[model samples]
Target chain A: MDPYALKKLNQCRRERRAALLVTDLGDGRDRVVVEGDPVSGLLGEAVEKAFRSDKSATVEVDGRTFFLNVHLPPPRLVMIGAVHISQALAPMARMAGFDVHIIDPRTAFASPERFSGVRLDAEWPEEALARSPLDAYCALAALTHDPKIDDPALMAALEAGCFYVGALGSRKTHAKRVERLTAAGVPSSAIERVHAPIGLAIGAASPPEIAVAVLAEIIEALRSRGLEARKGEAA
Target chain B: MPEEVQSEPLDPLMTAEDWMKAGKDVAIATVVETWGSAPRPVGSHLVIDGEGHFEGSVSGGCVEGAVVAEATDVLSDGKPRMLEFGVADETAWEVGLSCGGRIKVYVERLG
Candidate 1:
């Protein structure tokens, strides 16, 4: 427990930076690799791989085994409606290791009783998003099916580069929504990022089932995006 | 295997740091690899103090006892050990991983 390493680790945690602590089993030497730091060393490739996957691993470097301990900021989920689907989605998302927040200008639906252990922002999506900016680790879901509510949030999520942006609606509804977004000056490529029909094709007929499908789609997006980003880096 | 217990979102590194700050010897076991029906995913952690108290789960309940035992040694020797348990391993049945899955855990003393 070197004081220097401990200090750096605490700093990284405070800064919400992803990092890896590479520990050489042979000599008990430890080195910290904060995200965006150079990965050129004995543990370079393995560290890079671990960073991309956000998974820790034991790697053999030049015949010496080392453990890469990964530290990542918690994933966040921002829901743009306090509808029934959100009631189901919030708890499930929290259970899956996400910091869940629900934003709805409609205070009646966004009351504490509806979302009992979740953070609620009874403000408009734009105001809530401005207060808590979305990051690359965030997933945004628009479930109200009200363009006035969902469209602004989707636009904000796109601008913020959220890892996942999904909206609940039928294909026709999304088509109309896309047209409105395009008319509203959202780029076609950005509009393409929305996962309309929101969830996977799970034939979800109930709110809980729909919530499951949506969460699964969000996780898929997160993992697939990580893989694609890693591939792009390799290329 | 023990029934899977739902864990709240608590940061393992922070927990380990708090334990260390409180002057307790601690070891952390991480699931580095898994194959088939592994209860926990890679990067899952179980922090163990010298007195056998622990937080988090590296393998639901299948091989936690063995991991905790090895973590005790890690705390004493300040050394790290990589352990493997699965249906294919000799201690799999003894450790109750009978549901069939392989998991590699790396246990080490954490400051």
Candidate 2:
């Protein structure tokens, strides 16, 4: 019921991260975790109380402990080809919880009608990616087999340090890609990070099957990124 | 409009952090060691709060039930437990960890 606690709770809620608002009640005898509406939730007698800043605050009702926090994560995923595989993969990625974007210069392919529920950017890769802004949490995949389109976009993805940079290609295509990347001055190790011939070996032969494989590989990379974060914490 | 629920699934590491911060007593079961063809890789985490609430996975639902029981014990007793599941063991197939690979899980009641 203190003025400071109420102000702090509102501030933290605006930030979308959760924190505890501890306060001293009138009796000054014991501390209780308050739940429900902040204004009406506190008991008149209890002196000390605490609750999470998020609307759903963590409060110990009776003997049970409550865990609550407002959830907000970074927005990340940009697909550099409006191909069929991308169509399948985009929805799957969205379901897995990513802010998905599909980019291609071809208006026919990158139209809203083609991707009804997805964000479609009808622009060339270089321009589109500049607006999307890839970061470590982001994952970039080039589903277009055309070298002119996918190659340059992949270059941008690598430069941005995207956690996962994948491209769909055959063994021969990847070989040519290696040569082109080397000639472009991209380090061999950086090129190695590209999941060329993208996706896990699910023997994927169709667009849908390939989409599953590609997403599986993306998940794998995401998991590895998580592992690195844990290791950093322990260290 | 129900503001589009942000779709990012719980990052396994963030979930682990949440477990520790709650002071609820928690255990982390990790696939520390793995052989070929494992469904989940080494470092895959299955975090369990003392109350049996959990996030993440160590294997495809195969060993989760058994691990949850073991984790429950670990949290109550505040000790560590090591578990192994693989095709070589009789119960491995029953638990789904026997999908042609072996994995060693270390369940530590983290501070």
Which candidate wins on DockQ? Answer: 1
lDDT of 2 by residue, A36-64 (tens): 33443333112112221112232444454
Residue A115 C-alpha lDDT in model 2: 82
lDDT of 1 by residue, B1-111 (tens): 111123445766677788888989988887877889889887788989999988889887888889889998899988788899988887756895766889888787875
State residue A180's C-alpha deviation in candidate 2, in Å. Answer: 0.9
Q: How far in Å is the alpha carbon of A70 misplaced in model 1? A: 3.1
Two-chain complex of model 1, DockQ on C-alpha atoms against the true structure:
0.23
Give me the displacement of residue A112 in model 1, in angstroms: 2.3
Task: Estimate every model's Cα lDDT from 0 to 1.
Answer: 0.84, 0.68
Candidate 1: tens digits of C-alpha lDDT, residues A99-170: 888899998988888877788888999888776788777899999889999999999899988899999999
Q: How many residue pairs of model 2 clash at the backbone? A: 3
Query: Model 1, stretches more than 4 Å misplaced?
Result: A1-16, A92-97, A146-148, A169-186, A201-213, A230-235, B1-7, B31-42, B62-77, B81-105
| Maximum-lDDT candidate | 1
**How does candidate 1 score on lDDT?**
0.84
Give the TM-score of each candidate.
0.77, 0.50
